[model samples]
Target: MKFTYKIDEKTELKMLDLQESEQLFYLTIGSKETLREWLPFIDFTQKVTDTQNFIQSTMKQYSENNGFQAGIWYEGKMAGVIGFHKIDWNNKSTSIGYWLSNDYVGLGLMTKSVKAFIDYAIKDINLNRVEIRAAIGNKKSRAIPERLGFTEEGCVREAEWLYDHYVDHVVYGMLAKDWLNKNKIKRV
Candidate 1:
């Protein structure tokens, strides 16, 4: 597996490591309020150990060949994370989930990172389908897939329990033939 993905000169994604727990935890705390609204795992992550546990789980996921979680680094700082929930090899499909630090909202970082992921999924892994689901209220999050030309498939009612309330999600999908990043280089 690739250790790092250079999104650009200023943006990069690294496979999450155990040593990054502190930095990851701090980044999570810094954006907890904003993240917690849409992500159910935020409230459960209260300390560095919690972040470490998450990393361990991702490590297991990697070892099992299910998928991976990558830390988003911007200009040498932890900015966020993007990852696959799992790969359904039988169907050649996978679902992606991501979160960005509140500080780095409008830099077009997420849109770029997501595009790279789609390219990797479709071109590198030869996955036939990619899906991204975002809370209906989160316009910014939902925009990534749309900006990348993903088709808005449908909505699932109360798809996720965010702390105390269930939020609806809009599902966006792209097929390998529909992905337009034909010129991207796939890491071997």
Candidate 2:
């Protein structure tokens, strides 16, 4: 949310290029063309306004709240969105959310992005816990956490209302210590 923590546009472009090899995608905060590509997804309909509103509001929230948000770039284009919500510096915790356009499905791009973001949050920001919650029945949504070594902490019944009626959510979490340990192995 600091607005100061920008991933360099050039680097972001390069990341998008690398992501293309893996079928990942991203969009800048206010890119109408990018958001347009994401609109067909059910998740975007819930909270996203138009390009102007989303960019203005999200930038404001990131500045005011000290949070992080980024576009998911895939195939050299913006294909999705991801961010850390409800960041608490005092508590050292935050919730993560993401959505991918259907065009980018069936690849492990989300998992790679999640791992990259988790590394940034824990190692760079010094956060303790990163949490992820997926709507019930969203197996693909939950798969990122499962692949990233997050614990399946259980479900919260009727926790979020999306698309229509209320829906249960499956929670997943990874602690800083666990991530550090995992890194040692990966480094080796």
Candidate 3:
């Protein structure tokens, strides 16, 4: 699968690579406190090597047609990461996950990036269903799916283990047919 996706002039999504691990590592470290509240694995990513390993693993998954992770770039800076956790080819479905730097919040960059990815998943990749799971209190994260017209399927109680506790997750789902019927989303 192709690794780069240009959402617009201001934003783009490119597959994670080992060469960028240092940058990603610093970005993660800088956002550790903010990201730790909802993301369980942040604490484990203490060094650049961890980020490099992650990029290597993601590349392996991409080669295997399992899934892929991409770095979200906004105005030439690496602002976040977004990707499918797994693509169930047999079922024609996939689950998406994303995290943006605190500085980039409220810019609608993720919403636009996700919309473009969903469109690519359904139209180009031929995936029929896409799912997004966000922690119950993460209104900003949940809003992306909502803004793009995903249905709230249900809640998974204590679905994710945060640093010190667990948090419930709200599941959102969208089908290819529904996506195609929705109003066209303009690229950001």
Name the candidate that leads on TM-score. Answer: 3
Please provide, for model 2 over 128-183, each residue's C-alpha lDDT reduced to its tens digit, 9 standing for 90 to 100.
99999987777778889998889999999988765456778899999998998987
**In candidate 2, which residue ranges exceed 4 Å CA deviation?**
1-49, 185-188
lDDT of each: 0.90, 0.63, 0.90
Give the lowest summed-lDDT range of ten residues in model 1.
179-188
For each candidate in turn, the TM-score is 0.94, 0.73, 0.95
Ranking by lDDT: 3, 1, 2
lDDT of 1 by residue, 56-157 (tens): 999999898888999989999989999999999999999999999999989998998888888888878789899999999999899899888889999999
Relative to the true structure, candidate 1 reaches a TM of: 0.94
User: Which sections of candidate 3 miss by over 4 Å?
Assistant: 184-188
Prediction 2 global C-alpha lDDT:
0.63
Error of model 3, residue 187, in angstroms: 17
For candidate 1, the lDDT comes to 0.90
Winning candidate number (lDDT): 3
- The TM-score of candidate 2 is 0.73
> Which candidate would rank higher by lDDT, 2 or 3?
3
